[model samples]
Target: MTPHNELRLLPWSGPDGKPCFLSTDDTGGPLSRLADTTETAQLNVGQEILGHAMDVLADEEVETEELRLLARDLATALRDTLRVAVSRGHRLPALDPSTPIEANEGLRLSAAAFG
Candidate 1:
């Protein structure tokens, strides 16, 4: 069992698009693995959409309908990215509020930590 504070925010939503979470100490469990895969896929999709949006913006022949579609995609990607950030950020090591900031200099953050 995992502590409530240690609960992991799932990569997908639940009923009514509400946030979902997992409570487990098993980081390598099936659900954990699924969430990891989902997060990676979401990030890849966001990246691709960002590139497409840039290309669309650079074209003089772009239509209003096409711009609408781009906006939709961008909104979805931004939501996914924010969710991933919140989930990963919560999992990061906490620093002592009273400790000198330099005492935490050894900590490093990377995508691999979340995945």
Candidate 2:
């Protein structure tokens, strides 16, 4: 079985001394077997949301509070999208209803904010 909690967070300094958060995980099976699958797609979507948040932060004119709140909102959106996708996928008996389909760390990070 593949390892869990493979989520890797990468923070970089953005404009105006703001920190940008990014993460990538491949817990959804191997790429040789089509990493573009739905689970993987969901992960990619989450990354996209993060990237967009970074772009929003690059504007440099927005308030820090607003940026933090936007980052949190994006994180939640990513989590919700991933959760719904996973819930709709195959229902394994051995797997717990709460067992996250992607990396466990990714699940935890689903609520991460820029602050």
**What C-alpha lDDT values do all the predictions have?**
0.90, 0.49
- Model 2 earns a TM-score of 0.31
> Model 1 off-target regions past 4 Å?
1-5, 109-111
The window of 10 residues in a row where model 1 has the poorest summed lDDT is: 1-10
lDDT of 2 by residue, 1-115 (tens): 5333333222223588553332233434453124235345556667787787888878989888888888787877666465544433322223455767763434332221211
RMSD of each: 2.1, 14.7
Please provide, for model 1 over 2-109, each residue's C-alpha lDDT reduced to its tens digit, 9 standing for 90 to 100: 444588999899989999999887878999899989999999999999999999999999999999999999999999999998998888878888888898887787
lDDT of 2: 0.49
- Model 1 Cα RMSD, 1 decimal: 2.1
- Measured with C-alpha atoms, the lDDT of residue 4 in candidate 1 is 42
- Global Cα lDDT for candidate 1: 0.90
Candidate 1, number of clashes: 0
